[model samples]
Target: MGSAREALLDAAYEAIVSGDWAGARMADLAARAGVSRQTLYNEFGNRDQLAAALALREAERFRALTGQAAREAEGDAGAATAAAVTAALTAALDNPLIKATLTDDTSGLLPYLTTRSAAIMDVFREDSVAIFVERWPDLALRPDVTAEVGWICETAFRLVISHLIVATEPVETTSRHIAEVVRRLMRDLTTT
Candidate 1:
């Protein structure tokens, strides 16, 4: 099994995914984790910290999957970008906690993704930029190219996140469209 902290995090995830983020009391989460409320507080400090930890954990999970997609596509940045976007979009759609966090107004989880995104985005951008660097090592289309691949990766990531939150179109369609855009950009850069 997992450690006590891991178990607590798992229980918190379950509670949040079950549509009880607002109603899931700390004592209740503690009970579900088979820990005392004092233990929960000692482990997570407070509700905001617990939520932050949860969000970071989820983000890390998505990043790892996306990184795997990029790695599998190997030497093919376009395909890798597409694969990563599709993977993230697909996973997000299947995750109830993510759906509720994005669409549910009462969960109070949206701010962690929106208003408090800078810290998360910084970490995400660093890791994602590394993925792009690994995918396209000689992308020196211009003298001032300056991490163009990173820009594309971050932009695609933002588009996917926006699509997840606003849902302007079907996830499949949006992912395909993102892939096409990334492919076209990569093509243009390689040609010049």
Candidate 2:
């Protein structure tokens, strides 16, 4: 049942990404996933829940990308972290599914992109804490602060990326400035 629920959500999302906003309709989603309309309602509650699920799933992908960036920060933590952060920001800006997700005019996709998907934000923060701790164990006095730092870092990253991606701002113009700010923030706060 869980697998079917996920399959329905995946199908709904695929339709959405391919410019089939109408397919996000509960009946269409059910048909696409070979499920009954009652099943969708029973499992996911409503269309909005389905959309939120899809958003969360996409957020997981972003988390995976960040995890890759963190793993790359293995030994030489500072330089590697700076590079990873820049790369993560770039990926968030360039993510195609995110672009399409934001393009949905009906479901208020932009707010969902930031607000409802906040759960995944926590996932990234926790994951980054582990990665950063592995790289810079002595940086924090209490050990748990890495998650706090990561949350700030990701929030700052989202601010810049949201502006650039949604507003089509010049990435080159803002990248260096944002990079410096993030660097200083991490250096100042993370050091005990």
Candidate 3:
């Protein structure tokens, strides 16, 4: 059994999934979670807060999936990086919220996730860095190299995100390109 906050988040996610962010009303979310609007307000403060919470929760979920992909690749750094990128790309392609977030029109949630998401982006990058450092400790090289690797990994993430947003080519092609980049990065790091 989760807390009211988690339950409310779940309800909010379901509402957002079933409909759209704009359509997910506070009353509906409250009713879905068996809570009152006042309780929802008290828990999340406002709709913007609720949206932020939702985005954070989803980011955590995506990071977990990416981390699992890295872990599943065992100790092979290149494999781990490629696996993580593949998982992220696949998830982005499959998830509606991600698709909506990258799209230009509707949802009104894209800016919350992209342009206005410095804090969330920081968290996302940190999480990815942790995953990379865990799987490929070489990424933790001398003097803040971990930060460098983290930024590189985040760049790959952004590239994949861009591919999803642009929808210019097949996901497989973008995934292959990212995997190659990760492979090259791993090679360069290990060689240096």
Model 2: number of clashes?
Answer: 0
TM-score of 2: 0.78
lDDT against true structure, model 1? 0.75
Q: List the global CA lDDT of all models.
A: 0.75, 0.66, 0.72
Candidates, ranked, lDDT: 1, 3, 2
Residue 173 of model 1 has an lDDT of 80
Error of 3 at 80 (Å): 2.3
Per-residue accuracy of model 3 over 1-192 as CA lDDT, tens digit each = 248899888887776665555766888888888988898999999887887888888878877898788778765555676677678778887897776565525455676655766666776678767777776666676647776776677777677656655667666666667777867766766567
Rate residue 21 of model 2 by lDDT.
Answer: 64
Tens-digit per-residue lDDT, 3-37, candidate 2: 88888977777777777865457788788899899
lDDT winner among the candidates? 1
Judged by whole-model lDDT over C-alpha atoms, candidate 2 comes out at 0.66
lDDT of 1 by residue, 1-192 (tens): 247677788878887777777888999988998988998899899888888888888888988888788778754566777778788888988988798787667666788777876656666667766765555555543434436655766677677777878778776688678888777766765555
The TM-scores, one per candidate, come to 0.82, 0.78, 0.81
Model 2 poorest ten-residue lDDT run: 73-82
